[model samples]
Target: MIDAGALTRCRHRVHLDAAFPEQLAAAPEDPGVRQRQDAATAKREGIRRTLTEHAPDRWVQIDREQSARRRAEDTLAACAAGADRIWGAVLPLDRDVGRKAHCEILIRDTDRGGYIPVIVVNHKVTDPGRGAVTSGMFEWEPREDLARKPRGQARDQMRVAQVYRMLEQHGFASPALVAGAIGYGSDVIFVHDLTAILEDYDERFVDRLAIARGESATVPSKIGECRSCPWWPGCEEQLTQTHDVSLVASGSRADLLREAGCRTIDDLAAWDQEPIEDWPHGAFEDAVVTAKAWLAGAPLVRRYSQIRVTRADIEVDVDMESYQEHGAYLWGTLLNADGISVYRPFVSWDPLPTPDEARSFAEFWTWLMAEREAAALSGKTFAAYCYSRAAEDKWLLDSARRFVGTPGIPTEDEIREFIDSPQWVDIYQAVSDQFICPAGKGLKKIAPVAGFRWRDADASGEASMSWYREAVGYDGEPDLSQRERLLQYNEDDVIATKVLREWMSDRAESEIPLATDL
Candidate 1:
């Protein structure tokens, strides 16, 4: 039988070749199929490849990706014709005579004839980021059905809800199942040693199996009006009944109010909550004030500004640093800035926007976070993306142990308990992704690419992990000075990231404006 190590090596090579044809120039099958499957994996495909953490729900729901993997397997199977049963994650589920499930692999020592591992990392797999909302593809779906319910929770109860049907189609968010497949397939195949598995199997092989899986859910937001959002019709209907905000002239109100110079909602509601905000000379507020507006049943006063982006004259940029928790190193960089760089990730950077988003000592940290409440309706931000993930490891045990001076919980353990809570963002990922990472597209390699030059210092390209490993055994005082050094290193990380972004922007402006459109 083929050893698990060889199987891992073979499968990962297949994933990298199949997923990123352009980057590798290594076709899915030697060279014959280069026409389509191996065509330059476009920016879109590259971005799709970057989404390794995201995966399909089941073994069969995703076909196109399966077909690609199948083609890749055909060639590899040809070379490995010399070996016995091909070890795989998912077992060989019964299939119609010609249909393919997962390639059958043998486990030497399981009760159920050594059950195989199955992983489903299809690019087509969609998730309703941890905020508990479904994708916005259908119109009639309710808010609870689309935004709050898990597909797994409602799947078996399909007729009970629309979201249920989706879950029925996708399946549950599972780690063991996911880890089994990705351990040997696409997730980290190109980045790591999926190909480095052992030749023979033994009980020790279980511990040797290094697999990780988690709910790497992205946030839900509208690419457009609810037309694509599952909760569209429901939210829209609800918005119409309670307040006729249409007269406000915009989705976010400050702009329209600015034109009329009315300034506050009390003035608008006083004018019967009409379009009087558009009235000249603040004439809009005059009408509402004229009608004993206080008692005219206008509306509750809006206590804050409708639009939140403050106009700053200084040149500000965004930078993202990506690193694993507990590890003392830098993983990658994602840099971003206004006016100069394109907002999209994959579309802009060849690898896209990981480190480009991390700018200058992470000064944008304050403003970026400050704008959260108002920026909710805007494009995906660092906060929304980082926080909504599942806690699948003990890596953050130290951070959980640290006392953050916040009001929410009483103890570090409590904060750790809620670390994966959908409402909170992972500060580690957020801080690293925003201020340090250059191309978060690949955490392992981006740090070196950005020139933080950390291989010798941290050794593994992660940050503070050594501290974490050490802390696990004893409660020594934190090496504050080393922490200070690490902080400076992290700050340097953001600075290096910002410099790299400027270089990319300049390069894009001259050589690849189209690429920069990302």
Candidate 2:
């Protein structure tokens, strides 16, 4: 039986196939994947230990070093013996029952005297504002005591539902499912009722589990989950053989066509000829055009008559470098005005936020505004061009807020206006609205299609992040070469944006229809 965690997270049949006994015995362990798994295990253990400390007499700890089957047996024994709190319990449903479910924790309710299944997650449940908690990709509103909420409120409700059913099978009576999220200084627990939802999904769950058990062929539902899945390489080959529409389109669009009996790219391309009733306007046609371009092995770029921006006399291509662990450290700008091109960089070498970083951010902001003023005086419009402007724009605004009251820092209103104005050109959006990229729509993916190449062969945002981390010298002396490499990578990114902008502007003269026009 697969665990509740697996049932919740694994979206593809290939994921289940990889988990089969044969595949597990043959597949090599990835060090990065193992490291992440180990980290999660440690976090869960840490939380369990903390909970035990809080109520030593109530909690009973289960040793996890035992084999999977033995652990499940031990958990059942503990529950049968009426343990008050079963920590790290593993309850697996009967395999002969056709559907398999395994739940982690089974805590006894002090007042009700019944066990409530708990799912532990090693993620922060931050209260951004109000009484809402950040649960996965969405914010959920919970009760005052955080005891219960609507089951459909969160994206990861499958985990709760699976756990609820598993507990019910084991004869544990409970009104709600509990989720324990590790917080900064304490653990925040949220409860939700899933009785009705589980009742509705019982039959569908059995059918899906049957497919996972290899009773039927599994269809690939391509989604964001494919990115980290180890089975993607094999599944991608299968998708290519079948010419699945998901190979080119993703999310709801792919699901919509598949549900409408248009399974493959060819099927989707021919959908327009016999349109589905109440089809979304222009969506089918757009998918068809995109699919045709993918089959032809050509870049699909469309041109719109309503241009977002024209060639400006003064333009600055901007890119920012930041460590996920640390804050923004570098701001690279390629200034081009009236045939002259110059590179300017604002950098902070510190691993942590210091006065130096604050000064660098202030200087970058001051220089940019000065240039904008100069362009205004010269009767020329000034604009900042960036690929995937969200990250760069966020860092700029966040840095300004962090350095508020510091010298050379722009006011909140000034930064807000600049971000809201058309002066900030998001080249990514400009291209995405006009083009359909089957390869990818990322800066690195699309820039090369426009004949823009970085001087450094290994130049990438990920590589730059690694270089920045190494340059900071956590355990050894700082590597200047790494720092230099990161700077060059940032410079290349800005230059690529500039090149892409020019490429798009040149293509604007063509009589190609826009993606939306399709």
Candidate 3:
């Protein structure tokens, strides 16, 4: 299904890669040293020979000396009919097109500026023999045409129409928010990241959408969940009268008791003995007491903490790195209720693997946890975003579980309330959204936009970081100096997060309409 979206994403990858003069230019400094000189030479030479030999009469502009010209030519022949060629376009592709078939051609048109195009996409390093164009290109569509299609419909024609309709409906601002909200849902995040990747290369994706339609009814409804999810509150949803209560742990007791033929607490209390699953003892006394007191054969009201932390206990805004170094840092600003910072951003590093290294990292966590308890200094606890360098940090969870109590917390409501209230042990759930950004959610993309920027020269933003870790040097162990550098690198992320979160909250309140009527 060759469509605009697919092309756009490929185009985006190509365009983003354009910044790397180190990869494309022939001696970026010298101008003659295209990154892959040998590959370019071989490919150009092959093209020159093939074109010259195949159709002797065909005109050949032998600009082997000029890298841009060579690339331009390669791009031309790569397109259909090799007549109407394009340049400035191939720059947006996912493949780090090797010298093999990485050249492009340009053509001047009277109406538009110039058509930049895809070249020999089939020559991609990862997937062999599949040219960009031949491999299913996206189609162009009108906004009205697209709006009629349903989501999850992946047909090529339908996609073109759907994309146009979506673009017409959301435009940049709402789409961006939509993209963010989508990232909150795993399924939606996939779509957002995919669209971002595709939008870059495909010209069809860059079309101007109708702004009126962009502000469609669908925007608010879809975005509501992301904006209001209880998890980010350090507690996603509390038991509302209907949906909330049914969704809680205590609700499970209702089910259990009912199954045991003990619908009411009177039945439960008067039974000869409580069954194993009857919520035996101390399960839900308050609600039971309240219900028994009513004596109207009435139902009991179960309560669950629906707390949200406008503030935090240990506000550690985190970014994770899994390559050579498992790097992390903390921007823990323990503040008083009066907004005075007790402890500012604190950096920490961990190169330890295997949970057994608890001995080695105890000091690291102690310091981290100590910052959380900073409220002790002022008797004012805060909230935090609890995330880790690794996804499966069971030990981190276990540690929280182990130490969360010992303060005489007797009931699940108390535990839930304590965890959800302004005094949150961790704040990771709040920061890790359901969406995926093309550059990712790290400070590189997040920092500068929030009126702050990343510090440290070695700190390659998300793109470079991805290249550094995922592409090469992904060994479990990174350089010692690099490890420390990464930890410090993370500190800025936490700071960035704090800054960004507050900034965005303010902006949304001031700038956005915030009606959410869909």
How much lDDT does each candidate structure score?
A: 0.29, 0.68, 0.34
Better of 2 and 3 by TM-score: 2
Residue by residue across 1-518, what tens digits does model 2's lDDT show? Answer: 45444444445653466347687567766544554454456557766767677678876677778876788888778777788877776666567654454444566655655576656654434443444332321112334543323223333456556665666677775544444333332335554455445654565566556656766566676777776666678878989998988887776677778787888988876565565545453455556777777676656546456545445779998888875524688989999987888889999887754668888888888898899889999999889888888888778787878888998888778888998888888898887777766677899888887788988996766456557656977436889989888888888898898887877777543634455444
For 1-518, candidate 1 gives per-residue lDDT tens digits of: 12233222322232333334475553223221222222223322442343422332211222234555564344244222322222321212112211122332211112212222222222212233433322121111113223222223111111111111111222321111111212111222111111222222222222222211111221122122323233344444554344333223223343455456554434454444455334443344333332232233322121122212212212222223222321212222233334442221111111111333222112232343344433445553322222113432232333223323433213445435444444333333432332312112232333344344642364322334343222222235545554344344444444444444433333322322121121
TM-score of each: 0.24, 0.75, 0.30
Which of candidates 1 and 2 is the stronger one according to TM-score?
2
Which candidate number would show the highest lDDT if scored against the true structure?
2
Query: Native-vs-model 3 lDDT?
Result: 0.34
The best-first sequence of candidates by lDDT reads 2, 3, 1
Model 1 error, position 276 (Å): 59
Q: In candidate 3, what are the lDDT values of residues 1-518, reduced to their tens digit?
A: 12333332322223323333355343223221222243344444544454345445433343445675554444444333443323222222222211112223222222433222222211221211222111111111112221122233222322333332322322211122111111111111111123433343233433212111232121111112222222222222322222222122233454565565655434543445534444532444433333332333222121221212254433444343332222222223333335443434433333223332333234435554465567567665545543333332433433334434433213344334444455443323333331112222454554454477777753654323433332223445545555445555656656665665565445423422211210
Candidate 3, position 93, lDDT? 26
**How many residue pairs clash (N, CA or C atoms closer than 3 angstroms) in each of the candidate models, in the order given?**
79, 0, 71
